[model samples]
Target: MTTIVHNWSMIASGLLTTLVISVTAYAGALVLGSLLAVCRVSPLPPLRLLAATWVTVATNVPVLCSMILLGLGIPRLGVHITLLWAAVVAVVFSGSGYVCEAVRSGINTVSKGQVEAARALGMPFGLIVRAVVLPQALAQAIQPLVNILIACLIGSSLAAAIGVPELTNVTRALNNQSGEAVLMFLLSGLVYLAIAYLATRVGSLLERRLTRSQGAAR
Candidate 1:
């Protein structure tokens, strides 16, 4: 307890670091994942194969292994990315596979009739995807997308393995220094719980809003 009180600043900094990594990684996942989703549904065979291969590789590789490779292997090849950025890159690439699948599931839920109608209207492929597919697909995708974000939050702890001073790392240090493993871990868990609760609440609000908009459209 005394250690916790004295080291509040360190713990807070760790929490902030965890949040930064999770948020950045999730943002990158969304961008890359969205592109992959598009590729999976594209008319071209080569693009579909490329996207599928990326997702398969990213999904199959363990995050720790990927993190080690990103943090150490890349630098050995002459790239100079920091440990933090390396962790972010690993997370982004790894999470993108799940994101792509989730988005593709949403896209599948969109009515084929609407897509056909758009095509009948002579809309270009790009226009039809943007105007007809993405909106409803995104609405359907929201829950799964939020779940992935939560996974990202928990997975950010893996960054500690690569020497990032994230929450788990801070908690480990506190435990080592004070032998207050129980208290330090309890506090660390509480921070994660609080962040997860907020994220869930935000996701729920957005889901409800999207649902209402979809209903109004009908």
Candidate 2:
């Protein structure tokens, strides 16, 4: 306990790093994935192909391999990025594939009639998607999207491999210094649990609010 109490700042910083990575990565995944999902359902064949190829390749690549490639491979090209951003890019690229799938599935749930009505009213494709498709699709995909975000949070631990000093990495360091492996790991696990619990609560609140808005509209 003295070790934990004394080294609390290190542990807290590690947890903060994990959280920052998770948030930034998840936001990037959502934006990129939404665009990819739109392209997947686009009228243009080339756009569809481009988006589909990205999803296929990103999903197939191992997360660690992606991180390694981004971390090491890009440096050889004379473009330098930090180990942390490399991890963020890898996570966004990988997680976007799953996020795209979830969002596309949600888009499918939307009524064809509504889209047709929007088209009949002379709404452009972009406007139709923005006004009619995305809102409903987002509501439908909320749960799955939350799951992906949670997975991203857990996956962010992989950043430790590249020396990110995130929760897992710092916990390993703490364990080495304190020689209390079990205690260090237990504390790390609790931090992860707290993050996950907070995420679930936020997700539930969002879900309830969306439900209420939908009910009010009807």
Candidate 3:
């Protein structure tokens, strides 16, 4: 109790770091993944090759190795970055690979008629995606994206290895300082579970709202 009270601020700092990394990583992953997902379906062979190669490389490589290479080695090539940024790179890279696949799967479910209708209406490719395709794909894939977010949250803990001082790192430090191992772990676990729960609930609500809107339209 005493140690927890004394070290609360330190723990909070770590939690804040974790939150920052997770949110940035999730956002970056969504944008990168969505683009790659689109590319994976593009007509151009070169674009398809680029998207395929990116997904393969990102998925195959160990995230830690990717982090070290991008965060540390890239600096030698004049791309200086902090550890947090490094973790962001790794998370987004890995996350986008998974998300690209998921988004592509969702895209596959879109009817050919829908795209044909959009083209017949003289809608540009970009406008069609913004007004129709993205919304549909996102509706179908939101659950998987939320699940990926959960995985990314857990993975962010690994950033502590490179000295990011996220929630897990603070827990470790507090554990060593206080010797209240069980309670400390329980607290940290609950925090993680709470975060995951909130994300899941938000995704579920969005899905339900979309379903209802579709029903209303019909």
Provide the TM-score for each candidate, comma-separated. Answer: 0.96, 0.97, 0.94
Per-prediction count of colliding residue pairs? Answer: 0, 0, 0
Per-residue lDDT tens digits for candidate 3, residues 124-187, read: 8878777878778888998999999998898898887777889998998889888889988899
Flag clash pairs in model 2.
none
TM-score-sorted candidate list, best first: 2, 1, 3
> Which regions of candidate 3 fall more than 4 Å away from where they truly are?
76-78
lDDT of 2 by residue, 66-183 (tens): 8888888899999999999998999999999999999999999999999999999999999999999988998999889998899899989999998899999999998899899999
Worst 10 residues of 2 by lDDT: 190-199
TM-score of 1: 0.96
Q: Pick the candidate with the highest lDDT.
A: 2
Alpha-carbon shift of residue 50 in model 2 (angstroms):
1.2
